[model samples]
Target: MLYTPAPLHIPDGFLSILVSVVCWAITIIVIGFAISKTNKALGEKQIPLMGVMAAFIFAAQMINFPVAGGTSGHLLGGALAAIVLGPWAGMLVMTAVIAVQALLFQDGGLLVMGANILNMGLVTAAIGYGLYRSVAGQSKTVKLTVVGIAAWLSVMAGALLTSLQLWLSGTSQLEIVIPAMLGVHALIGLGEALITVFALAFIIQTRPDLIGEGSESAKASRNWVFAGGIVSLLVVLLSPLASADPDGLERVAKDLGFLSVGQDAPYQVIPDYTVPFLGETALSTILAGVVGILVVGVIIVLIARGMKAKS
Candidate 1:
């Protein structure tokens, strides 16, 4: 299943406040570099796609699946976003997604923003992309399968990095967490692959032109961008049956009893899902999805506009 452990985000108390603050600092630094780097490539137009991808991926996360034991989690979309937009834009988009999830969903702590961004954003966008280009370089024939594999590998890589970070923090035994993380993530990676492949396949069919123009510039599609917006909106509107089975990371952490050492602290934001008109359960997820989508859409438009980037 998962190539990595249950690392959607380190639950509360796993990291210290100092560690959390450091993480945010790192995120800020990396983002500065990321923005500059993106501007260098396709100008500012690429910025909007970052926001668009974030909304799309955030919405996708709303739909959870059943793992082995009834625990559930949603797609990270790092690989999918990277593959679609290329690494540079992918990192930016992923950063946006993670940031919003931290702020709104409270899925990941605000304090650990840096570590979270690096784990999900840079790792998935950069590492996964490097592997894809290296292995499948321009092979349009097997692009779907290749991308499927890439998405799987990307999730695995992200999870592995997360596990490593946890290990570095000395939060838990890496020996226990690493295998648990990888095994569960391997399965979860399958879901990631399917989603990415299907989405890419659809894009290829309807608007192949939306892909890269040369290197990784202008890798935006009207349908996919719209589909991303629409699908995310759909996830917001629909009642996503998030699986109850502990996600790969959570499963491993539980199996190893990481929870024993890892404390579950109270959140600053109660009812993490406090969207208007949404209850405490699944409907909140829908409300979060919709609000997240619209917020991200506005952010994307603003970024693109600022960058003077094209759609």
Candidate 2:
């Protein structure tokens, strides 16, 4: 069986080179600002916690839940990251995770990596975090409700952007792609919302310090070992149970007759999140997921440490 990344994530050849280049330029500019912001705002002690959070997000994203009508959607993690690590630092963490997913795990194309990061990282993180901030100072139930709504909105926002990019690339018509993408993503967004709320509630109970002061700054934690271990186990164990149904984006693409637009990457180290030696079995997928978690964790730690050093 051929392997493709969950969520499709704007595979290669679906976007024009011009669009890709523009997305890359914008991503670089925004991430530069994020790096500077994070450097000034993040504490030295929070570096390791950032790594664990990244790992947790990475693992959570691997658990794709089934939506209605034979479709699935996974956590995008932008809002969750922003909620836990502030918008700037969270964006940086998300960018690092997506970059590793594309470059090392082959979950997204290198060419379309910029677009993926733009859709899933910058836009979602900014909008979700902004909405979350707007609803602050409410009751816990209200805040969680608002977080749910923001999470849903964030997924829709990314879906809208994906549709627009696909339309611009001549993959699908705006009339057809927009509604299809939005419709499926609307449901997907619910899953994102629930997961975000649940995860946040768990953290609030177990480690409120990670949520920090005002979502713009965080308190440090030395207990990341337990959190990281739990996340690592989840990635290794539950990833094999991810739904086989096409994700929201892929379902829309197939239903809209644009699925053929995707092309294989020029090269892949671990194509479709499967280990080469393991040969497309459940074990291969689990091993790949574990490796991805570790890679993302380490990269986030290094990035956080660098930001701390610069500060």
**In terms of TM-score, which candidate is strongest?**
2
Tell me how many clashing residue pairs each candidate has.
27, 0
Worst 10 residues of 1 by lDDT: 235-244
Task: Kindly list the per-residue Cα lDDT of model 2 for residues 57-148, writing each as its tens digit.
Answer: 78777777676787766687888898777777788888888887888678888998999998888877776666565445556787788788
Candidate 1 CA-lDDT value:
0.61
TM-score of every model?
0.61, 0.65
| Residue pairs whose backbone atoms clash in candidate 2 | none
* Model 1 per-residue lDDT tens digits across residues 187-272: 88888887777877888789988865356333333222332333223322321111222253354444443333333332532445
**Model 1 CA deviation exceeding 4 Å by range:** 1-7, 16-29, 63-74, 135-137, 216-311
Ten residues in sequence with the least summed lDDT for candidate 2: 220-229
